[model samples]
Target: MYLIAIAWMYVVVMMTIAEAASPGGTLLGAFFTLVLYGLLPLSILLYILGTPARKRRIKARQAQEAPAEGHPPSGTSSGVAPDARSQPPAAAQTDSVSPVREES
Candidate 1:
């Protein structure tokens, strides 16, 4: 994420440099044009810093995946695996039925 931000900043800086190279209102015009183009890195900067959804998802994902109380996840185990039948099914339940069910 930091790398993305850094790259975004780099693009923004390059844009500012390009704008500086241009003369008169042309530079400013080009600046606005750059903004008009979605490729402008400023949006990415704002999104990385400003968007609540991105922030919340990042926080939630980090929390959900973090190592808990000094116990790491058991990914390297060589022991016998547990029986699958003992565990409950992990399928999603759907409440919405087919349109035909409405008639019934």
Candidate 2:
């Protein structure tokens, strides 16, 4: 892919040089030709084509940086105390007073 891009850029550079050297061609036109024809499209194409590689690199890096599966991350717990493991959840209280409604 890079080889193709390089070849394409070479062709565009030659075209730019020809445009610049032509009797009626302005240097500004040649510059625009190089940038518009060569740089912008090539950059966009490379970025689009390289997406899968970028994703793979990111995934590999994440896998490498991840902790082992056997151990949990630090600063986090299972939320249950060791001694409370045998206890059942407490029932809700039923002693609260009920709301009084107007006689209307």
Best by TM-score: 2
Q: What's the distance in Å from true for residue 33, model 1?
A: 5.3
| Residue pairs whose backbone atoms clash in candidate 2 | none
Per-residue C-alpha lDDT of model 2 across residues 1-104, encoded as one tens digit per residue: 99999999999999999999999999999999999999999999999999999999997776666564533333324433334454423442246788999998
Mark the regions of model 1 whose C-alpha exceeds 4 Å error after superposition: 23-25, 33-104
lDDT of 1 by residue, 60-83 (tens): 776677555443434423233434
lDDT of candidates 1 onward, in order: 0.58, 0.81
What's the lDDT of the predicted structure labeled candidate 2? 0.81
Worst 10 residues of 1 by lDDT: 73-82
The TM-score that candidate 2 achieves is: 0.65
Measured with C-alpha atoms, the lDDT of residue 97 in candidate 2 is 86
